[model samples]
Target: MAEQKEDTQRERFKAFSHVFDEGTLRAIHKESSIGSFEALQSPIKIGKEANVFTAVKGDELRCVKVYRIAANFKKMYEYMASDPRYTGLKRNKMSIIYTWAIKEYRNLLRAREAGVKVPKPIHVFKNVLVMEFIGNKEPAPQLNNSSPSNPEKFCETLISNVRTLYQKAKLVHADLSAFNILNHNERPVIIDLSHAVDLRYPNANQMLERDIRIMCEYFKKMGVKKDYKEEVERIIAK
Candidate 1:
């Protein structure tokens, strides 16, 4: 039975091997060996840079994000190079990808410490990141797909999270939008923190303003009133 199970697992990995490189496969196997997850189930989201999948860890579910080796690393380096944390980073493609994964892990930890709602990071190795699954039976829908029942309250709570993320965490989510936020149990859960950067980044304020503007405009369509500039000021206020 154990041999059969191993064969099945190997086949499962083989199925997805076409999408990942040998190094990524080894990393995933390493994660499995460490009991991070038993097996990867199905892909949840496929973005330009990373692919997210649902994985089974013991009895509960977890999320596994794999950064694509063939992704636009040049664009990633361009974005990451500005962050103070990665100031002297080299131009190596694989290094940038690995660093990007590490950045997201750190960002999630910082945001959680700041009391912001996000997926709890489990572990990060190479280009693989395991995190808590934010959902009931299935994964939660994005804010754009599932509008909150109470738009005003939800908007307020989301803004508060953003404020805490900026003030307490001292980070700016460079790419914030309804598409990357999950509407979990009428609450907002921010995701895609790979682009979030330290406040010292040259374009942090600009990115923060853009984030607030996008969120405010999204909530406005749902009848939530908010001035983007005032919101930005409130977030940055001491």
Candidate 2:
């Protein structure tokens, strides 16, 4: 039984390695030992610096975001350096990528606890971050592609989520927009939190305004009347 289990794990690792690097394979194996997931099913997204995969844990589905070890991380290093939470982090490529994953995992946990609609983080090992998959059998589409049945309600819900993400999570996404928000059954699920920063970050206010501006620009095209200043106040209101 032990040999059989070992063989299965080896096969799983081998299959995963076809697309991932040795370091990423090692990271995923470490996470699997903690039961983060049984096997990686398939790649669901190919983002700028990371790839998202669907994994199975028993009968449940989970998301595994793996930062591309070879990705150009200079932008990330600069952005991450500004976040007070990541002060003193090494500026090396690998260190920056791993820290980005860690940041996303921590941000997701904080957002979830604060009642923002976000994927619940499951585990973090090296550059791999696992979280509860936010979708039905297949993953949800971005708001840009998945137009809601009721645009007004969708806009309202999105604003509420942003407000919660700010006032409760005490963080700014710094990159929030229709592109990063999944439209799951008309509800919004915010993703791509690696760039989020605590409000105490020196650029937090600017980041918040930028996020709101992006959202407003996207939603305005959808015919939602928006007052940028009013919306910003609404999100930060006491």
> Which candidate has the highest lDDT of all?
1
lDDT of 2 by residue, 1-238 (tens): 9788767987977876777888898888888778999888888987768889999899999999998987778988888887788889897888888888899999999999999999999999889999999889899999888988877788888889888988899989988888899999988899989889999889888888888888878878879888877888888889
> Which parts of model 2 are misplaced by more than 4 Å?
none
Candidate 1 per-residue lDDT, tens place, 152-238, comes to 999999989999999999999889999889999999999999999999999899999999999999989988889999999999998
lDDT of 1 at 96: 90
Lowest-sum lDDT 10-residue window in model 2 = 10-19
Off by over 4 Å in 1: 1-8
Worst 10 residues of 1 by lDDT: 2-11
RMSD of each: 1.4, 1.3
